[model samples]
Structure formats: C-alpha cells, structure tokens
Target: MATAAPTPNRTPPALRRKRRKELATAVGFLSPWLIGFCVFFAYPLISTVYFSLTHYDGFNPPSYVGFKNYDYVVTKFPFFWQAVRNTAWLVAVMVTLRTVFGIGIGLLITKIKTGAGFFRTAFYLPYLAPPVAATIAFAFLLNPGTGPVNHLLGQLGLPQPGWFNDPNWSKPSLVLLGLWGIGDLMVIFMAALLDVPTEQYEAASLDGASPFQKFRFVTLPNIRPIIMFAVITGIIQTLQYYTQAIIAGQVASGVVGNSGQQFEPGFPDGSTWTVPQLVYNIGFQRFDYGSACVVSILLFVVAMACTALLMRRRAGLMGED
Candidate 1:
C-alpha cells in the first residue's frame, strides 16, 4: 500500500502530433510577418540603438562613447531645448485643432443634402497636393509684403501680420498650413460618422435627448476610438515635422543661398526648428552623427511613450474599466 506512486499525466502521442501540426500551420502563416519583423523593424531598431551609443561619422568607423552622446544632446546642443518646446506646442495645438475641425467638417458635409460629393472632393484636394509644392504655394500666398493674403487683409482693414517672417507668427503660419491639409483626417472622421448606427440616434430621440445630449452620449462615445486614432497619428506626425517647416522657413527667410550653401533651419529666430530639424542639422549639416543619433533615439523613445499612453487610454474609452 505504501509503494504506490502515480506517474504524471502525459499527452497521447497522436494528440501531441496533432498539436504540433497545428502549431506548424500557424507558424507557416506567420512566417512572412516574422521574417519582415526581424529583417526590417527589429534590425533597424537594434542598429540605431547601438549606433546611438557610438561616435560614428558616415565615413569613419564607429567609436564607442558610452553615454557621452546622450550627455552632449542634453548639455551641449543649443537648439535641443527650443526644438523640444516647438515640437510640444505643435503636437498640442495641431492634434487638438485637427481633431475638432475634422469632426466638425465631417458633420457639416454629412448635413449637406446636395453636392456633398463636390464639397468632399474640394476639401480633400488639398491633402492630395505634394507637401513641398503646397508649402511653397502657402508661403507665397501668406508672404507678408507681396502675398495677396496681406493685401486682402489690408483692404479689409484687418491686421496684416508678417506670417513666417516674424518669430511670433511663424508657428501660427505653420499651423495654418497644417489646417489646409487636414482633409485626410476629416474624411476618416466622416467615414466613422457614417458607420454609426441609425438605431442609436432613433433610440436617443425616443428618450427625448437634446441634440447636445444625443451627440455627447451617442455620437461621441461611438466614435471615441476613431478620435483617439486621429489624435495619436497627428501627434506622431507632428513630432516628425520637417519638410514643410524647412521650406516655409527657407522661403520666409529669403535665404536660398548659392548651390551647396547650407541655409540654417528654424528661421525666424528658431521658431520652426523642430526636433527632426535638429537631427538633420546635427547629423547631415555638421556631420556629428553621434549627437544626431542620440537626439533621434530620444525622439524615438518619446514617440513610443506617447503611442503607448494613447493606446492604453483607448481601452478605457471603450468602457473596459
């Protein structure tokens, strides 16, 4: 009676074989994505993280410098703090304004009974324009002295502030440019609005909810995820803001120097020099690749943190508690 010891339960050979086959099939399906992940994203991220710790110009071999690169970015880079402040402002203002206006415009277009298609197309056309061309065009139009916008403002007896020329107005002019191309976000909002169940509106109507109540409780809650998506993407894009800002800066500064001449970015007193511009100036302009990598790494960390925070809030918005 004392000698009886039971053996652990074991899976049957046939069942184990079936499970293995199932796993193999799943892996087969995931192979492409797995390969891509390792080859592209994983490899590049690892390389960047490693390079960020070393002093490596493009032509020379990398010299390991421990945390010195990070130290320089924090303590030595003159434009680092200004870039951070500008980027934060851009993210805050652009994301909020884009979300509000996109939703509002979507609602407006839906309310139109006739020529909805025409209005949608017209609004979306700006988003389709090449960013470089659009920025150049906007710079010309908003030119303080020669642009028609200033002339029209003058005729109407309104303040014709120097748009990109003055430090105070440069950021605002960039915000205006952003607003012009907000049609992509607006279209997404419109699609989300259209997908909201008509039954929900009817239910709210039967409950005698006011229009504000209906929108607040019905429309907004239903589309909260979409709004979150728009905000997060806008934040990411704002963090990487470069081309249009640079173009606007160059045009506004009127410093298109001779070929091979490097014009300083963040014109109008460093108002538009975002973090990406800082990276470009450090890495490409000055050829201090190490410091540039450090800044890039810092920006990457920030973008990841922002994305994670937003995604975590998404579950809460859906009443997941």
Candidate 2:
C-alpha cells in the first residue's frame, strides 16, 4: 500500500458543487441574524465595556481611565449601594410575591367552573395597561392627600399610610403595582398547570393522598419547570425594573415632566432608586457615560449570574425528577 501511493479521497465535482451551494444557502439564511447580532448586540456590548474603562461624556472623545469608573461606582458613589439594595429588594420580595400571586391566581382560575373566560380576561386586563399610565394611575390613587383611596380609609377610620409618597411604603407600592399586572405570569402558570398529567393526580388520589398532598407531590413536581421559568424571568424583569419605579417616584414627587431642573430619581429619601434608573441618571443626566457603563456592566453580570444559577438549579431538579 505504501508503494502504490494511496489516492486521495475526494468528492465528485457535482457533489462538491452541491455541498458548496447547500452551505451558501445555509449561510444566506443565517446572515440576517448574524449581521443583526453583531451590529446591535455585539457592538453595543463591546462599546459598553470599552466605555466603562474610559472617561467619556456623550460629546467628548473617550479617554482611557483604567477602572477609575468602576472604582468610583464601588467606593464613592452615594446612591449606587442604595440603588443596588432597592433593586435587590424588588428581585427578592417583588418577584417572589408576583410568582406566588400568579400561581395562586392560576390555580384558582383553573378550579373555576363558571365564567372562566370572564375571570381570565378581567385578570389579564391590568397587564395590558401601559406601564407609564399604570404607574401614574396607581400613584394618583394612593396619593397621601386628596386621593380617593385615602378618602375611603378616612371614612373607614383606618390609618391611611402614604403609599408612593411614604419612603417605607414606596417599594411596597411598586410591589402592589407589579402584583396587579401579573396576568402574564398567571397565564403561563395556568397553561402549565393544565398541561400536568391528570393521571398523576388520580394516582395520588387513589393512594389516599389528601388535596394538599396531591398538590405538593403531584401538581408541584409536574409544574416545577414552569415555576422555575417564571421565577427566573421575574428576577430578570425586576433587575431591569425602571419605568414603573421612575414614574411612581415622579408622580409622587409632583414632577410630571422635565421641569428644567435636575430631576432627582428615587424620590422620598432614595427608597426607589433602581440600578437602571441610576444608569440613566449617570449617563444622561450627569453625562458620566463611563460610570453609567460600569453600572450597566454590573447589572448585566448580576442578571446573567442569577439566570444561570436558577437554570442550574432547575436542571438539578429536573434530573431528580
């Protein structure tokens, strides 16, 4: 065989041409997404990373500062830690409450025998409201003075705590607003609950499992994946929570639009300053794009880490299943 000089294995010209054409077709189909990803996502991410290392205002050329931005954000920024705390509270308390309320509503809806469609529609309508409008409406409704809710509380001889205006109640007000718009999560949970095998429930029932036992052992296990999904998404959403919090703060502070003055975010003693709001304030308001990018990078990292952790835990749970 060595003496004979082994011939090279090669495709026929026709086959080669066909393969090339197939590859071209595949590339053609993928080109749009590839171009979009590079232009939009990849470029922005790279720019952000670079900007985070530099001192750049929007107009001036970016000058490299070598982690000074990060240092400032970590050590010197007054509102940075407060914003992180507020965001963490939203991620922890708000997300958990939304998930619980969503699941509870979903279960209740699934158990309803009459006017199911009506109830579903009624519940979902709030989620359809524009975030800005909803925040404004909620803020007005809970206004400490001259709001209908306070008026009602006064009539009932109950303490009317300032909802959005009070520092202690501001985040809770946002949580309530979030819970009011949990129709999307409710729908997801309802679908997942319905998809669980009825046979599993029947088996648990036949085994003398009580209603709570069936729910715990059968229903929960079956819908665990969906719950994980909802929780993870809720976490991510709460991490980027900006619009509602900002609007609520502005409404409560009586600053509707640009008043030609520096609009301080996180009104009522900085109780509602979120990371995204901090980023906006830094980048646009103060023109400290570098520090803004640092905050954004931190946010991105936190969101990715939380999502990965949840996903890994979900995978482990699924393996156990």
Candidate 3:
C-alpha cells in the first residue's frame, strides 16, 4: 500500500490574517487594564509597604525606623488597642447583621412575586446614597432628643434612648447604620437564589416541603459559594468602614477643637471611634505617620486573618451547603 504524499492544504491566508487580527484585537483590548493595574494598583501597594516600614510623612523624607512602629503599635499604644477593639466590635456586630438580616431580606424579597422590583429598588437605595449624605442623614435621624425617631418613641410612650449622641448607643448606632446598605449583598443573594434549579423546588414542593424547608434543602445549597463570597466581602467591607463613622465621629467628637474649639467633632459623645479614624488622628492630627502605619498594618493583619478564618469555616460547611 503506497500512501500518497500529504497535501499541504495549510490554513488559508484569509484565516491566518483573521487570526492575527484577533490576536491584535485581544492584546489591544487588554492593554489598558494591564497598564492601569501596573501604574495605579501595583505601584501604590508596593509604595504603601515601603511607607509602612519607614517613618514618612507626606512632606518630609522617610526615616528608617525598623520595627519600632510595629512594636510601639503592638506593645505600647493603648489607643492602637482601643482602635482595634472598636474595629473588632464593628466587624463583629455589623458583619453579622449584614449577613443574617441582609440574606433574610433577600430571600423574602425574592419569594415575593408581587412588588419584587419595587422592594429591591427600595432596599438598594441606601447603598446607592452617597456615604457622607447617608451618614449625615443618619446623624440627624438618630439625634438623642430632637430627632424624629425619638419623637416617634415619645409618641408611643417609650423613653427615647440616645442614638448617635449617647456614648452607650453610638457604636450600636453605627452597627445599625452598617445594616442600611447591604443592598449589594442582598442582590448577590438574590442572584444565588435565582440559580437554584427550578426542578429542585418543584421536587421539594411535591415532598411537602414548607418554604423554610425548601430554602434549607434547595436554596441554601445552591447559594453556598455566593454566601461565602458575601461573608468574605462583608467582613472586609466592615473592616474597612471609614466614611460613615468618620462623619459620625467628626460630628460627635471635636476633631481639632480640644484646645478652645479648634477642631471638628467626632462621634458626639466619644463613642464610635473606629480604627481608621484613630489612624487619621494619630498620623495626621498628631503627626505620627509611623504609628499610623503600625495601626494600618495591624488592621490589615486582623482583616486578612478574619477573612481567612471565615473562608476556612465556609470550606468546612461546603458539604452542608
């Protein structure tokens, strides 16, 4: 048997040209993002680590402080510990609410066929509002005496608890405020709900499954990955919460006026001081960038550790979901 010589019917020139064009197009498409990542994100992250290690204010040249900043932060500074405590509390309370209630609301809204769009939009409004505006609005609403909430309490014959204005309730108020903007998380949960195979629900219904049972057996399993994502991002987001508390703290405690009213107020009653606010006070107001960097690093570690722990927990729960 003589095999004929293989014919050289290679790729047509037109096809080769098209492939080349596609390669060029793909490269062109990705270049902008690649360039942006290097210049903006990569550079700043590297610079931050450098800045963390040395004593550098924006104005002066950085001085090498070795591990002094980290040491002082961990061992010496009570304020650092206080800020960490405050941040931890915020993370603990706010993340829990954001997860539990936010997901519950998501499931409720999804299960409601009528007015689903309206409820979704309404629930999402807070997350869309500007942080400063939202914070200020909350401050006014939560005013201890004159706020409408207190007025409502009075109308109901209830003693009005001080909200943002009280030392006891200010941190709690911030936690509650954190709950207002879980619209994004809710949306994610809604999508995960939608991903639950319709057939599964039909089966569950035939098995006499109640709504809670359906959710437990069908919905929760389908949404486990997303739930994990929500948990991770929720913790990270709460850990990085700066704007609302910043505004609240600014409004409540005087920022620059400790000596004869020269400063802005932070949480009015000395409550709701978060890690970032404390970092700002130390690094900028007190001109201690080294200490600020130390606090920043500590917060970074805690946030990362918290996120990792949650991820591990989720992994273990993966079988259940």
Best by lDDT: 2
Misplaced by over 4 Å in model 1 are: 4-24, 256-258
Which model scores highest in TM-score?
A: 2
**True-structure RMSD, every candidate:** 2.1, 1.9, 6.1
Report the error of model 3 at residue 272, Å.
1.3
lDDT of 1 by residue, 1-321 (tens): 588789989999999999999999999999999999999989988888888899988999999999998998998888999999999999999889988989999999988999999999999999999999999999999999999999999999999999999999999899999999989998999999999999999999999999999889999988888999999899999999999999999888876544676789999899998999998999999988888888888999999999999998887756762
- Which is the winner by TM-score between candidate 2 and candidate 3? 2
Candidate that beats the other on lDDT, 2 or 3, i.e. the better one: 2
Return the TM-score for candidate 3, rounded to 2 decimals.
0.81
Question: Could you tell me the TM-score of candidate 1?
Answer: 0.93
Cα lDDT of candidate 3 equals: 0.78
Scored by lDDT, model 1 comes in at 0.91
> Please, what are the lDDT tens digits per residue for candidate 2 over residues 50-142?
999999998989999999999999999999999999999989999899989998999999999999999999999999999999999999889
Rank order (by TM-score, best first):
2, 1, 3
Q: Per-residue CA lDDT of candidate 3, range 1-321, in tens?
A: 999999988999999999999999998999999899999978866766677788877689999888887787778865556666777787778877888887798889978989999999999988998988888888878777678998999999998987776778888888778788878888888887777899999999999999889888888888878878877887788777788887776555435235555443245534566677767777877777877877776677778898789888887887554
| Model 3 clashing-pair count | 16
CA lDDT, every prediction? 0.91, 0.94, 0.78
Q: Which regions of candidate 2 fall more than 4 Å away from where they truly are?
A: 1-16, 257-259
